[model samples]
Target chain A: MDLVFFKIALALYLGASAGYLVFLLISSESRASVGFWCAVMGFVAHTLSIMHRAIFSGFFPLATSFDALSAFAWLLVGIFLLVRYHDPSPIFGSIVTPMASVLMIFGWTLVYQVTEPLIPVLRSTWLPVHVTLALAGNGVFAFMAIGGLMYLFQERLIKTKRLGRLHRLLPSLATLDTINRHGLPFGFFLLTLGIITGAFWASSVWGSYWTWDPKETWTLITWFVYAGMIHQRMVLGWRGKRAAVLAIIGFGLVMFSFVGVNALLGGHHAFQGANRFMPPSGL
Target chain B: MEIMVIGLNHSTAPVEIRERITFPGDHDGAVARMIGDVEGVEEAIVLSTCNRAEIVVTTKDVEESRERLIRTIGEIHGQDPSVFRSYLYVRHGADAVRHVFRVAASLDSMVLGEPQILGQVKEGYRRATKARTTGPILNRLMHRAFFTAKRVRTETGVGSAAVSVAYVAVELARKILGELRDKSILLVGAGEMAELAARHLNNQVDRPIVVVNRTYENACILAEELQGLPIRMEQLEQRLVQTDVVITSTGSCDPIIGKAMMKRVMRARRHCPIFLIDIAIPRDVEPDANEIDGVYLYNIDDLQAVVAENIGERRKEALSGERIVSEETEKFMHWTKTLDAAPTIVALKEKLEHIRATELARLNGKFADLDPAQREALESVTRQIINKIAHDPIVFLKRTGAHGKQNLYLDAVQRIFRLNGAADNQNEGEEL
Candidate 1:
């Protein structure tokens, strides 16, 4: 039943994403609303599917690498729905729906689907808190990155003397900049709390507050990059192309920390036994 | 009743004829009352905006109403009916309803998608209602026109783009800077073009507007008119840092603002975005200033190009608006056609009842020897027979009428029953 819901949710998200892309091409107000409702329905089903996994598995769906990816995608969709509920602009969905869908596909195809029992160190209440905060922070950063990317696209067209379709489809540059400006600090705050919770959980379980594991190291790097971007913006008035470029770079590091660090480098955080799930047939 | 419009718009009449035919705005209600009192006119409204003069009415005869309307317009303007005959355009029934909807939606406006026409039409409806010259048909038509206008506005982007150079500058500034409520504006000269741009900004930008000119006295006058501060031309460098948008339309032969000077200002302002509109003929700002990273400089031609592009887009959106108007018009026409069946149905029932009553009275004389219960039964049976006979024709009239074939069906039913006079006065109290 959980798998059925997951599959249905994936299909909805894909359809909604395609609808939003078509909306960008057509640029109709009614079509935008239609695409928006499709995304909202998909997000709702996706949430239920995640809840289904948690209820049946007897743990929060944040332990295995596959669970982590699914949880991250769920958080991304949740944030998007929240943003769109307030903003109601289809441009945000045009970027976020695809991102969440891609993450979901990766989780479904590459990782083991079976819900693993919580390993001893992962059984604490702090574990859920740490994972949820970290995933939420990643979701916020992804949203900010989308805003940054849009700002760059709009700015480039304006610079190139081409005020055409894309220029009209996208939101104003000020609105996109405001999103990045607010999302940066908010994401940083969540990441800070998540890091603190991880430290506390680590001390209680692993007998150390700091681990320097590959995942841990890359997460720190991602945090620093975003923190630096925020600092430059607030202190030195970094904006427009410079701020957008830095945000994209920061989001790149965030993606690496969330996905690449776990898949490529061995880490204690990889609780689903990554190599065992790897297909025997090489690419 | 029939709904009709006889009018002359920008396309049909020259300005001189339009002015002569237009009703005075203050006396619009009086004119509507006068038109309503005309023979065959049941309800009337006179919409006489600067660009068009139209008299819309619910009437008993389309051809008679058109003649009366044309003569009334000519009399009010003290001209002969022949002078206004060539410019007059007349439409009745569904075509008239569509015309009203199109006018309200701004699809039939002189400038397609202009916003003021909807408000002007509403004002006309208001005057008619105030004068007690609008009945159910005109009231319903005006309400539907409003709804269609709202639908077109939301479903299409017809009125969303700016179509003038000054308005384009404002739109572009809003796009770049989001809200201009907190952004200060600097007018580079007291020229007419610069003052026009400043006037456009007055309603939008709430911050102080600073006007500068070579002659300080002219600057002061323009500044006072704009409710802004007047500064000397030497203060241009100082104002550039403080202002977010600068509109330059000076009459100087050379470029007033140079690249090197803008580069210095960008550095001082920490590279914050600044919008520059050079609407001057020869261009007030140097073209090289456009190359600066933080400066957005649009010349007169560039602003005109954007306006032209936006106008083209609005025209495209107007096509969709036209579709919405047509769809709504069809629905309204169906409703009115269904309404047309009511009087015919009444007339048919009255004719059938008269025949049944006459036949029953004749039978009563022979049945008087029967008991009271038997007489009652006979009367009830005869009434049922009459109802059964009238039911099929009534249903057919209403059904066919809703498809806009009511006139043909109604004519046949009336001729077969010889009930034309019976329904004429009854329908006068109802809608068409």
Candidate 2:
């Protein structure tokens, strides 16, 4: 039933992505509304799916890679909807829905039965709190990266004076810069809290306060990147294109920490244990 | 009645000729009323702008009205008819309607997609309304013209882009800064184009403008005229820190603001974005300054290039606007066709006949006990009454149609009888 709801959410998100893609081309208000409502519906179904998974698993459902990715996408969409409610610009939707849809697709492809009981190490109260904070922080950083990309696009168009249609369609550079300015410190703050909580959970479970695990090291690296960006932005007033580029680079670090660390380096948080639920030698 | 537009615009007349026949201020209404009093003209609206002078009217005889209108306009302005007659262009009927729509949409403007013409036309229509010179036909036509103009404005990018260098600078500022309400603007030196751009920016932002020049006295003079503060050129780098937009048009031999100085200024400004518009021939700001992180330097040529590109975009958008105007003109003409006596008279008869047949059929049961002769007499008497009731209106419509006053009577009959149904209601709303 959780899988069914997840698939429905995925389909709705795909529909929203398609709608937003069309909106980017023609820029019709009705098309944006279609995309917005699709995203709203997708968000609803995704919430139900997440709730169903939590109730069935008897814990917060971030044990598997699929659960973690789906939650990340859900948080991103939620943040997007909240921002859209205030700004009401469809341009962000054109960037956001496709990203969320891709995340949903990645999660859907890795879907597997969660018949095995929760792992001994994962069954802890701090599991939900740490993962939720980290994923929420990632979601915010993703939005900042989107804003950065838009800023560079708008800035280039302005600098080159080839304003064509997209220049008129996108938000101004200042607005995009503001997005980065506000998102940086908040995302960095959340990541800091997430790392601290993970340390506390690790101390309680593994009898150690710190570990040189690959995920831990990568998270620290990503945290340091955002930390530097925030310092530059606030102290030196590094903004506009420079700030946008740093934001994108910082999010790149975040992606590597969130996915690459666990996939490539066999860390303590690696999904190899969760992949045992997969059927052996089957399609 | 036939609608006609007789006008001389920039294309057909020189400024001298246009100036000679312009009816300024209070003279517009008087001129319109005078034209309304002409022998064949039933309604009149005189639109006199700097670029064009036109008389829009409804009349019985197009040729007689046009000839008398030309002579009367010349007489009002104390110019000979022969002096300006060759410059005037006339359009009648559907062509006249299309011309009004095109003018309102700014497609027929000297600068394509210029916005002032619509407001000018609206003011002319308002004056004609105040003078009580415009009747139902002209009123409806003016309203439809305003609607077409609005559709063209919202549906196309015809007037969205800036065409002048000064306005393009303002537009680019808005694009980069998002809002200019609090952004400070600096004037580096005194020049006509620089002052024009500054004044344009001054209207949008609330911040007081600052003027700096090599000659402090000139800066003070220009600043006083623009209602701003004057500063010495020695403080150029200091002022650059606080300025969000700078318009420099100095007659300097070399760059006034160099990349090195601009880089220091950017550091002092904490890398906040700044726009520099150099309208000078030799360029007051170094071209390399544009490479700075937050500096957007647009020289005179660059601004001109942007203006050229925008004008081209507007022209392309004007094609779509023209399509809207022609489509609306066709729709308006179709509605006018419904006002013709032939259709209204036929529709009136059909409506009355249908009513009579329905009433007679509804009372058929009551007359069933009577003989066939009684029923036949009932039907004939009802038909006769319907004909008698419809006779006066049908004749009135026909007579007015011949005399070129058919629109008023036909519209009245159509409304009182609701003959045109849903389409008529929709058109009535559109005219309003």
- Top candidate when judged by TM-score against the true structure: 1
Q: Write the per-residue lDDT of candidate 2 for residues B1-432, one digit (tens) a residue.
A: 689999899999998898887876544477788889988999999998888889899987898888888888888888889998899999999999999999999999989888899999999998888888998788888988999998888677788778898888887898899889999999998888898999999999998999999999998998899999999989999999999999999999999999999999998999889999999988888898988888888988988987888889889888888999999899888777787778888898999999888887888788779887977888789889999998887777777756756677878888888876735645656654
Report every candidate's CA lDDT.
Answer: 0.81, 0.85
The candidate that wins on DockQ is 1
What is the Cα-based TM-score of model 2?
0.83
For every prediction, compared with the true complex, DockQ reads 0.43, 0.41
**Pairs of residues clashing in candidate 1:** none
B217, model 1: CA deviation in Å? 3.6
> What are the per-residue Cα lDDT tens digits for candidate 1 across B200-285?
88779777799899999988998898899999989899889988889988889999899999999998888888989887878789
Model 2: CAPRI class: acceptable
TM-score of chain A of each: 0.93, 0.93
Candidate 1 Cα outliers beyond 4 Å, as residue runs: A271-283, B25-28, B342-432
